[model samples]
Target: MAFSDLDFLEENFIHYAKENTQSNYANKDQVPTTPGQVKMMQELAKQVQDYGVKSRYNEKTAFAIGCLPANTAGVSPIGFFAHVDTVEYDDRFPIRPQVHRNYQGEKIILDEANGVFLDPAEFPDLRNLQGQTLISSDGKTVLGTDDKAGVVSLLAALKYLHEHPEIAHGDLYVAFGPDEEIGLGGQRFDPADFPGVEFAYTLDNGRPGDFEYETFNATAADLTIKGTVVHPGEAYGLMVNATTIMTEFLAALPADQVPEKSRGHDGFIMVTDAQSSVDRAHVGLIIRDFDWDKFLAKEDLVKNLVDRLGQKYGPDRFDLRLRRQYENIYNGVKDRPYVVNLALDSYKKAGLTPRVQTFRGGTDGNFITKKGIPTPNLFNGGGNYHGRYEYVTVEQMDKLTEVLVTIAAEHARQSQTGRDERPLKKYW
Candidate 1:
C-alpha cells in the first residue's frame, strides 16, 4: 500500500524545501532548524501522530513524530531517523527546481545558462534515476541532497502511512535532527523521546540499495616529523628532508589500501592532512575497516610505522600520537543479529538489494549504537554527498519510505508488550 495521496506531501514538501532568507548565519546555510525548520516540522507533525514522532524542538534543533497502524493487529515499534540540516556549501541561490514529464529515461539540464552542467559522464548514477522527477539545485548551486533527500523520504513515508492506515505496522518513530554536519546531532538526542524498540535505521546513506551494518574503525593519528633548519649550502647529509622523509613514511604503509584504491571489505590507511615547509612538517591519518580486529591491526601497523620511523629519525626528528576517535559499529550490533539481518530483509521486501556496506567515514549511527540503540545507517537515494554534483532519485526516496514501513511492522512483531525486547531502557 502507498500513501493515501501524494499531493499533500508534494505541495508542502516543495514549499518546505525552498524557503528564502532563511540563511541566518554566514554562507553556512545556517538557517538552523531553530524556529523556522522546527515550525515546518511541527506543521508536518500535525499531519499524523502516533507518538509525537516529529514532536517538537528540544535542546539542539530536533523534532520527533510517530506513525502507527490505526488497528490492533499492527506489531512492533521502530524508529526511522534522518537529519534536516544542510551542509555549508557554495552558491545555493535562487534554486528553480523543476520537474520533468514522466521521467522518460533521459538526462536533465538543470540550468545550462550558468556555465554549469549535470551530464551522464561525470555521474553515471543518473542512469538509475530515470523516469523519476529528480529534485536538485540549479547548476550554479550545490543541491542540499546530502540530507534533504532523506528528510523528504521520511516525510513521504509518514505521509504514505497516514493516508493508507490499512497497511500493517506498529508504532513508527520518525525523527529529523539538526547540526549533524557540525558533529553535534547526537549530543542532544534523547533516545527516550523516541522510545520504543531498541534499534533504529538512519535513512542517510550515499546511494540507493545501501544498508550498512558496519563502518570503519576510525581514529585520528597525528605525527610530526621535525627537522633542523640549516643554510642550504650546509644542508648536505645533516639536512633531513622532512618532506622527503614524510614521503618515505607514507610509503611505509601499504600502498594499495588507500580509500581511492580500496573497495568492499578492503581496509585502508588515509592521510587526511599533510603540510610542509623547509623547517617543519606535520601529517595526520585515519585508519578504517569493517572488521574490529582488522581495524585494530591496521591502527597498530600505523603506530608501528611511526615508531620505526621515529626510531630511524630519532625522537627529536619524529613525534607521534594516536587516539581513538570513533569506532566501528558491527561488533556492538552483531550480537543483535536482527539489527542488521532484519534490515537486509526490509530492503529486499522493498524490492532492492541491500548492499550491506562499510562506510569510508563515520556517522551518527556509529555513536548511536554505542548509546545502546543499535541503529544502523540506511540509504536516502542520494549520491556525491557534500558536493555540487550531488543528486537523489525520487524513486529511491519512495523505496526508502517503503523500507521504513517494513521495518516498523517487523520490529513491533519481534517485541513484547509494546516495548523493546533488548535490554536498553534500563541500560540506556
Candidate 2:
C-alpha cells in the first residue's frame, strides 16, 4: 500500500523549496531571523487549517502551531516539530528543484556546465533509491531538503490522518518553527504553546529508519587574552604578545579529543575560529559530548587552561566566558523509555527496521526536552543535506509519512491496552 500522497508531497515540497527561507546567523536577534522564514511559516499556519487542525502563527516566537484534537480517549497528547528555515546558502543563485521520475541508478548531472553530479559511487545511498522519484538542486545552491523534506512529510502525515479519521489517534500537535539551523528556534519555543504534550519528535536529519534519542550536550566558549603592545625596536620585558598567549592556550587543549578524531559516543573540544594580534586575541570554540561527566570535564579543561595561563601571565590578562548551548536529550528521557519505544514500535508497524543511533551534534529536541517534554529526533528522508549535491526520494518521504501516522495510531492503541515500557539500550 502507498504510504502517502506522492502528488501532494512533490507539489508541496517544490513549492516551499523555492521560497528562499534560509536562516541568517547574523540576524539572529530577530524572532524568525529572516523575513523569508516568517513569510513561509505564516503561510504554513493557514495551510494546516485545511487538515482540520486548530492552527495559528505566533508572531512572538515565530512558530506555526497546529493541533489535531484527539478522536480517541485515554491517549496522551504528543507533538511533532519541523523547522521551516533552511541553512544559509549562496544567494547569487536561485534554488530550482529538479525532479527525476523512476531514477534508474545512474549518475545524475546536477549542473552540466558546472560538472556537479550526484553519483552512486560517491553516495552509495543513491543505489537504494533506484526506481524512485528523486529531487535535487541545479548544482549552484543547496536544495533545502535538510528540513523542508521534514516539513512536507509532517504535512502529508497530518493530511493522511485527516482524510482517514477512522484511524484512531490521540491529540496530535505539529509545530513549524524558524531558525533551527542557527539553534535559536527551539531555545525560543514556549512549551506553553504545546500544553500537556507528554512527548515530541523532531523531524530533522536522518535516513528512513533512523531514530535518535541520544545527542551531544553542547556549549560554546569565548576566550580572550589581553596584552601590552609595544614597538619591537623599543620592546624589552614590557611587551606581552596576546597572539603568543592565545597560541599557547590553544595548544593546551586535548588534540586527541576533536571532531576529526571523535566518533560514536566520544566527546570533542573543537576550536571553530580564532583571531589574534599583539594587543588582544580571541578564540571561539564549541564543546560536545554524550556523557555528562565527560562533557563537564571538557568544560573544566578550558577553565583550567585559562587559569594556568592567567597565573603564568598576569591574572588580569585572561578572560573566559563559557555558556551552555543545549544538553543531550537522553538525559531527560533515559528513565522514560516509552518515548523511544513508541517510535521504534511504530517503525516496525510501518514495515521498517528500527535503527537507533547517536547524533554527535545537538538538535531542537535538546532545548525542547529541557522544557519538561522529552523530544527525540526522527528521519527527514534525504541525503547530502545542506549542499549542492543534496537529494531526496519521494518514496523515502512516503516512508516517513507512514512512520508519523503509525506513531499516532499506535500511541492510541497502546494507550487503551498498554505502553511499551521496555528499557532502552545504548545504541552507540
Candidate 3:
C-alpha cells in the first residue's frame, strides 16, 4: 500500500511538537525525567490501539510498545523505535510550530520582530525541500522535529497497514521510547518487550536517504584530586594547590585528539567540565571512538596519566574512575549482514538512493543493539536539530513512512523466497 497521507503525518507532527517534551538531565533519576514525556507516551499507547495493534505504556522504562500481528505465516517479527523526548531547551518560551505550505525556496522569517530568519544561505538544505510543506519553530524555541518526525512517520506507516490489510507483512513492533536526547531511554529498553523480533531500526536523525549502522563507542571518566591547604605566610613547602594539579592533568590530555580537531572516523577524549579549589579538584570527561581497541587505549591513557601523577605526588592524592556508556552498533551487526542489506534494499525500493554514513555520535540503537537486537539508525527528516532553526517537511516524512512500510513487506518476501545475505561493506 502506497501511504501518501500528508495530512495525517503533518497533523500528528505538529500536535506532538507543541507538547514540551524536553528531557531534564538534572533529574536523570526519574523514569522519563519529565511528566510531559509520560503524558505523550500514554496518549500514543491509546492512539496505536486504534490501528488494531495491541499497545501499552510501560511505566518502568517509559516506553509505549505496540504490536501489529502478521498476516503471513512463518515470518520473523521486526521492530522500529522513536523517542518522544527532545533535547533541553529554554522553558521560558513555549514551542509553537509554524507550517509553510508548498515552499518556494525563499528565506523565512521565523520571528520578524525578534529578527530571527531561516535563510537559505545559512541552511542550504532548505533548497532541496522546495515545493514541500515545511514546518519550523517560531525562533523563540525549538520545534522538536528531531524524533517527533520519526514518531509521526511510524504512525503513518501503522495507519497505512491497518487501512490496507491485503499487503502481506510479518509481525511489526513499534516502540515510542523516552530520554533519547539525554541518553537514558535506550539503556533501559527491555528486549523482552519485543517478543520474537530479530532486528530493529531507530528512526532518530538524518536526511531521507541517510542510513547508519556504525556509531561511536562511548565511556565517561571522572577524576578527583586532593591537595593540602595552608596559610600563604606559613605555607613554604607545606601547601599543594589543587587547581595547579588540575591544570597539569588537563595539559596531559592529547590536544589533537578532541572534538574540535576530530572529524569522520576519528576518535577523541573531551573534557566536558572541570572545577577546582585550593583543597580539592574534580574533572569530568567523555571518550568516543569507533574502534574498540582505540577506545580502550584512550581509557588506558587516562589511567596511566593519573598513575604517573600519583607516583609523583602521593597515591592518595589522585583518584580516577571510568564507566562504559555504550558500544558501537557495528560490533553487533557486522556478522548479521542481512539486517543492513534489507534496509538498503527497502530504501531503493522506495526510490531513495542509499547513502550509508557513519554516525559520529551515539543513538538509541547503540544500547538496543547491546541487548542482542541489532538496531541501526534511519532518518527522521529534519535539519538544524535541537534548536529553534530545526525544520522538517511533509514530503520528507512521507518518504520515511514509505521506507517503513517497504521494510515490513520486504522482510516477509525475503523470508519466503530468500534472505539478502550480501556481505556488509566497510563504510568508514
Tens digits of per-residue lDDT for model 2, 1-428: 56789999999999999999999999878888899988998899989889999999999999999999999888999999999998889888989999999999899888899789999999999999888999999899999898999999999999999999999999999999999999999999999999999999999999999999999999999998999999998889989999999999988899899999988889999999999999999999999999999999999999998998888998899888999999999999999999999999999999999989999887899999999999999999989988999989888899999999999999999998899999988786
Q: What is the lDDT of residue 283 in candidate 1?
A: 93
Badly placed stretches (over 4 Å) of model 1 are: 1-4, 19-54, 60-76, 121-125, 128-130, 163-170, 206-208, 232-241, 382-384, 414-428
Best by lDDT, which number? 3
Per residue, candidate 3 scores C-alpha lDDT tens digits across 1-428 of 32569999999999999998999989999999999999999999999999989999999989999999999997999999999999988989989899999898899999999889999999999999888899999998889988999999999999999998988999999999999998999999999999989999999889998999999999999999999999989989999989999999999999999999999999999999999999999999999999999999999999999999999889799988899999999999999999999999999999999999889999999999999999999898989998889999999999999999999999999999999999999977
The RMSD of every model to the true structure, in order and in angstroms, is: 5.4, 0.9, 1.2
How far is 209's C-alpha from truth in model 2 (Å)?
Answer: 0.4
Per-candidate Cα lDDT values, in order, are 0.66, 0.93, 0.94
In model 2, the worst 10-residue window by lDDT is 1-10
For each candidate in turn, the TM-score is: 0.80, 0.99, 0.98
Q: Candidate 3: which pairs clash? A: none
lDDT head-to-head 2 vs 3, winner: 3
